[model samples]
Target chain A: MSVSVRKTYKLYVGGKFPRSESGRVFQPAGNEAVNVARGSRKDLRDAIGAARKGLATWSGSAAYLRGQILYRIAEMLASRRDGMVQELRLGGLTPAAAQKELDNAIALTIWYAGLCDKALSLLGSQNAVQGPFFNFSTIEPTGVIGVIAPDKPALVGTLALLLPLLVGGNSVVALVSSHAPFAGLALGEVLAASDVPAGAVNLLSGHRDELAKEFAKHRDIDGLLVSGPPDAELTEAAADNVKRVRFCNLSSAAWSKVERLRSLSWVEPFVETKTLWHPVAP
Target chain B: MSGSLSPTEFRVPPVDAVALEARTADLATRSIKKDAKVQGLKLAIAMMDLTTLEGMDSPGKVRQLCQKAVAPLPARTDIPSCAAVCVYPDLVKIAAQAVAGSGVRVASVATGFPSGRTDRRTKLREVELAVRAGASEIDMVIDRGAFLSGRYGAVYDEVCAVKEACGDAHLKVILETGELKTYDNVRRASRIAILGGADFIKTSTGKVSPASTRPVALLMLETVRDHYLETGKMVGVKAAGGIRSAKDALRYLVLVAETCGDAWLSPEWFRFGASSLLNDVLMQLEKQRTGRYQRGTDFSTD
Candidate 1:
């Protein structure tokens, strides 16, 4: 079966895939029509706008609905597993490891779906107090997360990491791996088709160095999930915005427990424990 | 978000060696004597590892030693409460009660005490237990093994996790300097710890023989002072282990005064973790004026 692919791969800004604000498009290796360039300040602002808009409803959404949306994305990705493998291989995954890549992708989705409920379960609390006031602690979403997905796991763990942050009701501005732009573009397609609420996930694929720096210093990006060892420049830039950075150190070959933290890294990036104190009343 | 990047904003500034020397001179001439039963002296900061107390002396004996050290200061003038009293995980409560209402804070070394080779959950648990036991400050040693092994993410994550475990208490990260030999390694460790949410970047636990040198203290303080310049957050610095005299504390204080500034010299930003050193500072003050050694009992351990 021959697939008639589109001539252009637009930038995923807000909820829809659109051409770059600069109207620029560049091609990565092995791709016909995908642009990997610098996203404009306007594109960043729009994603931030979408994130601010979506934060309430997404976080307010029931965990079941969040899990349902995530599980559905995984199912859809699984359904198109062969195409994903091809995309991964195109991005440099060996043909032998393509099946394992698909499995990892599927498992990542499910694992994150499970964690949506687990996060609240493990981190939340109801205090049995000495007073008549009702006090409880819930795992609140840290605003918009800035994600730099791993170049190696462009299809699976990267998307896996992104899904949990979104499902946890946090929006994200992702700098998809430049090396694996196709896989990121494909994942963006699946997210857009699902009920991910548009700006919840924005995929900016172009110059990895440029996008990573932008996300690092962008005040709009509340936290960062650096999917690999960020260079000193990137690390220093992220520090500029006081963006909470989660350095995801997944090697090019193996995916380990470290992968699990990438999801949490993004989710809790902007989290600050606000200890509210009130005088004990009569 | 990828693009060509500019230079980092978190670079350390040049040390004011001249200004530091001047402060040392000023400290030498100042008459720090007081009229009260317990006289307050401005000695260099001492940082204790708490775990080493096992070989030093008994708890009662240590308490007596602390009382004697503080005895020369004026009764109610508040001589900046012996920097801080550091102890093991279980002794935070005892230390807290011991130093209660005395302006002295009780710090407990947690996160596996000597080494940080544990799970996040376990590390956090150590912090939680220490905090719950009345530790006003927590000194957690970083996993140097993980850090040296190039596990930067794990190190960063663990430090943040331990910080969270501290609740309202301050967190002091100990970079066992004897282990992290080079100045560059010490600098990197200090920056990483401060960036990852440490309240203080300390040098050494004093387990090794050569603990808490001036250069290592200089390196950690330089990083902390730079962090303050960048973000405007005042992270404290503590020099621990083998700091046994007022002169030793003075040298570290001189370094802080030079490396950071006069603003950081207050007890809030400076600490000395010595068990037997406070008395020496008091003794020095007494010797400066009176030329005779007072009997140990003449100084009240009240």
Candidate 2:
């Protein structure tokens, strides 16, 4: 009998793969035991620190350049499509369904990449005034964002929620679904090779119940994107820092609606608007 | 005072790295919550030496730091002010003026600070200038080059000279343990600093990695305990750098209480050399009171 080699899926932090500080691991479906890093509150704290440090550089990049990087992510995903599809199939998805989901993930990434530069024009405004002054309003990224992925359709749902936030030039610390964590780990590998800056997108595979309160209360995170029903305790904790929270009801809406998923509203929640005025002489 | 004795006369036993790390890990698991947590948070706040030692530091920045040291959170009167404001020597006068009536002492980092590479005369002169500019405390760095080269006597003598230059001001000797590899070096450096007349022995300059780690702080606290047992003198310990959160600060508090007893818990015997740690502690205190976390923008940056 021949022995097959297996891979250990570690958490992506600061653009590097590291085991959990707690030194614990869990088995996701279709994978061997001790593969995924079972992250703790300390791991969450370290991820937040990495996101904060990457914010200045990621948010300061040109919109066009950011769009190019997002396109690069789609290309990387496409090249690794076969491996991802196989992993998804082993995690309980049918062959045809797995292929469709992979296609949707790539399409959604490209769609968001194209909208990076155009979001400002659609969401911003030029105010009309009676005085000799020119005024305008513009949107800016809201620093580091925290995300919680839903369990079902783990791959597409996570990409749909994450791409919009990244397109808006904000860094993310995402906690992948505990049920199907292998798909998220595969995506992390693709992101590492996609020219995405280190610390721009960190992925953690662990129990959501253990980390939700930390995601809400961490002082460094500026906004949160949670998929599924609104959690009362988590929402209340987020109020302590007055951080912005958006809940995506994946069960209520169709996941294949590209127009709805790619709308400007999805991007608006993670951005802040600033209005500027200047006096013009006659 | 003991000219006949050599620097190598005092000896420190070898440290068990694994055992020391395990002990620190166990102490970190102690849960401090509710009333006890609030008290710990307040005590930690009172032990802070709010520091800013950047090259870009100006008179205005030092004044802002002083203001922050005096009234950490003005809206909440229950919060106690910090122990002192730390800055470079040139800005000592400005910092002193900013906290003139606030009862917050001014501390200055001398002896070429992060790197003690200069001559003894220059180092002593720097100490004198800071004291003349109204610095109530001087934080001096030990010459790691001399100590690493097996010249323990030179390192001890330099610390003594800086202590004399401080006059009546309290002296804090920074070991810069990150540069000094091995636990034995840290143990020996702690002994040298205490016997050479350090009012308080510090762990780092906050400019290097592995600054003020739990094991390092634990070892230094033990040194203070042993020194007290032999000479009947109580020396303080300051854990600077990389201690950012309230939970970490609480762990240091636990180490001090468990090792050296509660006598060293007060600000006079313990201090935290940090700048951003104050805001995190305030946020936790507010969370305890309001049952919610606070926005960073609600607090002042300085």
CA deviation > 4 Å runs, candidate 2 = A1-50, A90-92, A120-137, A146-152, A173-185, A202-221, A224-253, A275-282, B1-34, B112-114, B117-122, B144-146, B149-151, B208-210
Residue B212 of model 1, lDDT score: 80
lDDT of 1 by residue, B4-111 (tens): 222132233444555544555655454333442222244342232223245444667546534533433555343334656677776666666766676666778888
Which regions of candidate 1 fall more than 4 Å away from where they truly are? A1-6, A30-38, A128-134, A230-232, A239-241, A256-282, B1-302
Residues A188-282, model 2: lDDT tens digits: 88889987888888899899888888899876789999987888888888876678988888652477655667777789899889999989887
For residues A1-282, what per-residue lDDT tens digits would candidate 1 score against the true structure? 999875465678777887777676677777655545446655665566577666767777888788888888888888888887887787777887777877777777877777776676555666677766666666667777877777766776577568767656687787777776777877878887778776677887667665566666555566787777657777777665466777777655556333654466545544443333344477
Residue pairs that clash (backbone atoms under 3 angstroms), model 2? A240-B293
Question: Each prediction's TM-score against the native?
Answer: 0.44, 0.83
Tens-digit lDDT track of model 2 for B173-290: 9999999999999999999888789999999999999898999999999999999998999999999999998899999999999999999999999999999999999988987897
Q: Specify the highest-DockQ model's number.
A: 2
